[model samples]
Target: MRYISTRGKAPALGFEDVLLTGLATDGGLYVPESLPHFSLEEIRSWRGLSYSELAFKVMYPFVEDAVPADDFRSMLDDTYQVFAHDAVAPLVQLDTNEWVMELFRGPTLAFKDFALQLLGRLLDYVLEKRNQHVVIMGATSGDTGSAAIEGCRKCKHVDIFILHPHERVSEVQRRQMTTVTGDNIHNIAIRGNFDDCQRMVKASFGDQSFLGGKTQLAAVNSINWARIMAQIVYYFHASLALGGPDRSMAFSVPTGNFGDIFAGYLARQMGLPISQLVIATNRNDILHRFLSGNRYEQHQLEHTISPSMDIMVSSNFERLLFDLLGRNGDEVRSLLEEAQSGPVSIEDYRWKHMRKLFDSAAIDDDTTCAMIREIFEHNEYLLDPHTAIGVKAARLCRRDKAVPMITLGTAHPAKFPDAVARSGVVSQPSLPKHLSDLFEREERFTVLDHDLKTVQQFMAEHWKHA
Candidate 1:
């Protein structure tokens, strides 16, 4: 299948090329030229397939030209074999008509592992065949850095550098990124917020000289189409488990970079029997405001309990807006640039169009903590802060048609012990064996200012030096 850049200038590419090149040359995200659909019979025929088989079937249409069916299948199976859960993605009922889709059952204990694991395998397969080496750079608020580090560590031909805001991430989250001793894995603690780290990564991608070198530069952030594509599978898994394409469903996603829920949007375009998609946000509620018809404005970066969602500007939302305007890349680019002038005012007609397919809400720290405590008391279920935001938002904004609303549980609660403890929900949680002794290890990182030139210089010095 061929992919088109949301911004029209970049040349259309096959799936594997889009997978490897995170952002389009025109500064747009890549999307499938046309979404592949499944007939009811075809959907039902997947009943007895293993997770790997189902993944292969769902992803084949997109990557058919770039990867053979057998080789891709082998890579998928090998990747998922290491997941902590037999069912890599599981659905657990939270109420009579509400369920939480748990997506953290992987080595890193975060939803990102679902995609990064597969990406690591896919990259190795292609690089080995061509005898090429790549330098991967990523920005993370919390989970993505750790998951990327774990996924690509020790690979002979891949070097990964993850930059995160220093001291802003939780203690466990910080250790997860810093503890990796692999020769190919490196972590940088930038002296700023997640948005700054993300900007720097994008700046690196736009560096023409860097892009032309033998040492390839790519991204693992959701800006990468492969990450978004991998995440789209879970929506189908949840929908089918809860009677999708047969009964309508809704989703509550704890959104940060907007890649995860954008995948759900793709699922709807693929003809899944889904209703409105709900976007849940923490205090950094730029997305919430956008959906509410208020001007989309970025506020001062505030560190919240749901630190991963602590983003003001969401990159993947650009993909959605580009699609929403009927793939008018020029208009999308103008809107993106105009927002820098001040708050972005969406036209009423345009907002009405967006509101038809999407719902949104924001929850503050106190309410998030209360949701965790209340859910644990009522059902003995432990939820991390990000998932708590989704649960609370789902309950508040669900429409009558949104039956069996599914909120994505993005991370394991043990990742944030302080928040869980503050909520008064006592449950014994064990650390992964590798991280069991992390508290005793000496933490190390080089802190740098948020200047783009400083970051560029650092990358130049460290390129392939890891």
Candidate 2:
């Protein structure tokens, strides 16, 4: 399978090259030139397979030519074996028609582990074969930083640097990344918001002369094709578990970077019979504004209790635009450029087309907490703040009550005790046994100003290869 950049200027690359190259040289995210489709019979045939087995069947087509079948299957076996649950992504019934898919069973209790664990293995397989070393530069609002560090910490070849907003993320989220000590892992706290850290990572990837041309950068963010590919598997997993192809499944994803819901869209393209995808957001609701009308503009970033969804810019939205605008790179570029002056809308026809299958809602902190307390009182099930937003959105925007609606439980509740307390719960959520000692562990990190040169210089000084 070949991957093409959203801007349509960079050379199309195979899966291996796309895995190694984060942002395309043209400052665009890479998407597949053509998607692999599965017939109903084909999707149904694998309904009984395990999560790892289903992942191999779903993802093999993308990397078939780049990685050998045996080696790839072995890597899949290793990637999923680390998850804490027997069923990696399991479903729990919250209501007769509503369910929650738990996605925090991995080593780092968040949804990102499904992708990053596999990404680390894939990087090791490819980099070791080429006998080369690389660096990972990623920005996370909360979960991605910890998951990326956990995923890449063991790899001998890549030195991974993750930047998160200082004093912005929750205490549990910060410790998850800062407490993991490794020669290859470095965490930086930028004195700014998530957008600033993301901008610095993009700038460094766009021009890597800061590394003295000695190394290429890998991406662990949703911008990487591997992360997206790994995410698509879970959508298929959820559907197959819920009896797919016979009945339609709908998803409500608490979105920040747009990667998770975009995976559901790809699942529909791959014939999983997804009925609806709800773009659930917190107060920082750029996606809701865009889908509600068509304006894609930035606003002031608010530090909400659901800090993971506190992003002004949704980067993965570009990939969806590439497909929605008929893959017209020039048109995509023009719309983005036009947004620099003020708000910009897509062609009316395009916006209408996207609205056909997608629904959106922006939930505030009070509503998020209310939903959390209400669910706990009704069903005795506590939801993390982000998942509470998703559950609220599902109830508000559900198109069909006949179809099963699944809200993605993105992270463990222990990650955000403040939200739990505000929900009026008497008992706080406790960390897992493995992380029972998280509070006592010594932390390590560097605080840096939100400047490109300072961030890059710090990376250059600390990078093992440099």
Candidate 3:
């Protein structure tokens, strides 16, 4: 399967190259040249497969040409073996037709582990075969940093660097990234918001000359096609669990970067029978604003209980817009160029087309806390701040009450204890046994100013290219 840039200027690439190249040279995200469609019978046949087996079935078409079939299957096995749960992504029923897909059973305790764990193995395999060394630079609002660090710390051919906004991330989130001790893993606390860190990562991808033209820069962020590809599997997993393909389902995803929900959008493209896709957001709700009002504008980034969704700009929204605009790269390029200065609105027909598939809501901190408390009191279930937003949005924005709704449980509640406690829960959630001593671990990280040049220079000086 060939991958093409959303902007349509970059040369088409196969899976391996797309995995390595996070952002296109023309400032676009990579998407499959054409999605592989599964028929209803094909989708129904995957009902009882194991998580790894389901993953192989869903993702084989994308990587078949790049990775040997046996090797890819083994890699999938190895990647999921580290997850703490047997089901990998188990489903918990909340109401008659509502469910929560638990996705935080992985090593790092976040939904990102579903993709990053596989990404680390894939990068190691590809780089080892090619005899190449690379540096992975990613920006995480909270969870991605720790997940990426844990995923790639053992990789022999890669050096990983993750940046998060200083003092913005939760204690557990920051400690999760900083506590991991590895010479190859570097954590930087930038003196700005998540967008500043993300922009730096994107800029570094656009120009890698700072690496002295020796080591290639890789990405662990959702911009990488592999991350999105791996994420698409879980959508299928959750849907099949709820009697999918035979019946339609709905998903409400708490999104900041837009990659996770975009994966759901892809699942529908691959014939998952999704009735509706809900865009759930916190105060930093540029995506919610766009889907609700068609006003795609930037606002000041707000620090909320859900730090992961504290993003002013949604990077992966461009990928969806590219499709909504009928894959017209030139038009996407022009619109994005205008958007850099301020907000840009789409044509009425295009907006209507998007509205048909998506509904969105922006919940505030009060509502998020209320939802968490209410769910806990009524159902005796705990939800993290991000997932609380999702559950709230799913209840508020769901078009049909009869259709089954699944809210993507993006992270474990222990990761954000402050939010959990603030919701009036008497007992604070504790980290799992493996991470019980997270606070006791000696933390090591560098505090950097929010300057791209300085960040690039640090990468150049520290990266050990062979």
Candidate 4:
């Protein structure tokens, strides 16, 4: 399938080029020119397939032109085999008509592994085919960095550099990134918030002359179309597991960059019968304000217990804007320019159209903790702060209680011990057997200022050309 830039100016590209060239030349995100849809019979036909089988069925069309069918199938099988759960993404009923899809049962213990692991394999395949080498530069709020490193560290033709806010991410989150030992992998702690880290990465991507004109740059962030493609599978996986195509489901997604939930939107576009999609957020609630009040406003960034959702600008929102404006890239550019100075709102009709498919809520830390405690006390189930926000939002914003509500459980509780403790839970979660020695592992990382030039220089000095 061909991919087009959301910003309109960039040339349409096939999946291979889009995978290698992350941010489009026109400063836009890449999307499939036309989505491949399925019939109910086709959806029904995929019921009993394994997670790998289901993934292949959902994602093969996007990559079929670029990757051989056998190679794609092998990558899907290998990528999910690493997940701790046999179901890959398992659904647990939390209450009557409410359920949680456990998506953190992978190497990084976050939903990002669902995409990044498969991304690494795809990178390896493409780079090797063309005998090319690339550097992966990504910014993470908390989970994406470690997951990117764990995902891409094994790629023979790639150098990986990930930046996260210094002392802002949890100790577990930091260690998970820094503890990995590889000559090609580097972790950077920027002396700023998640937004600063992200800004530096975007600046670097915009101009990579800092890489000395020799090495190509790629992204492991959700900006990559492949990551979004990988994530869409599990939504279908959950629906099929719970009697979908015949029955409708709603999803409450704990999102920061908006990539995870955008995958759910794509799932709905691809013939899954989704009743609603809830935009669940912590204190950083720009998305909530936009959905509920038609105001997309900028405010000072705040650190929260759910550090991953602490992002100020939701980058993937642009893709949705492009869609809402009838794929008019010029209008998206204009709206973004308006956003640069202050708050921005879409046309009234577009705003109304959004409300039909989405509902939203902004849960504060106190409420997040309360939900965590409430679920643990009543159901004996522990939810990390992010997922707690999702459950809370799902309950608050759900329109039809009859339709099954599935909140995307974004991370393993072990990753956020501080939040767990604050929830008054005496039972601390233990790391999985594979990560039992995580705390004992020595970490390697560099602390850098929030300057793009300095970061690019450091990346240049560190990595030898592959």
Residue-wise C-alpha lDDT for candidate 4, range 1-466, written one tens digit per residue: 8999898999999999999999998888999999999999999999999999999999999999999999999998999999998988999999998999999999999999999999999999999999999999999998999999998998999999999999999888999999999999999999999889887877888888888888889998889999999999989999998899899999999998999999999999999999899999988999999999999997889999999999988989999999999999888888887898999888899999999999999999999999999999889999999999999999999999889999999999999999999889845788899999999999999999988888888999988672
- Candidate 3 residue lDDT tens string, 1-466: 8888889899999998988888999999999989999999999998899999999999999999999999999999999999999999999999999999999999989999999999999999999999988999999999999999988999999999999999999999999999898789889999999999999999999888898778888999999989999999998998888888788999999999999999999999998899899999999988888888888889888999999999987888889989998999999999988988998899999999999989999999999999999999999899999999999999999999888999999999999998999999745898899999988899999999999999988888887663
Model 1 over residues 217-292: C-alpha lDDT tens digits?
8789999888988888888888778777688889999999999999999888877777879999998999998898
**Residue 76, candidate 4: C-alpha displacement in angstroms:** 0.5
CA lDDT of each candidate?
0.85, 0.93, 0.93, 0.93
Worst 10 residues of 1 by lDDT: 207-216
TM-score for each predicted model, relative to the true structure: 0.96, 0.99, 0.99, 0.99
- Give the deviation of candidate 4 from the true structure as CA RMSD: 0.9
Q: Per-residue lDDT for 343 in model 4?
A: 94
* Model 4 residue pairs with clashes: none
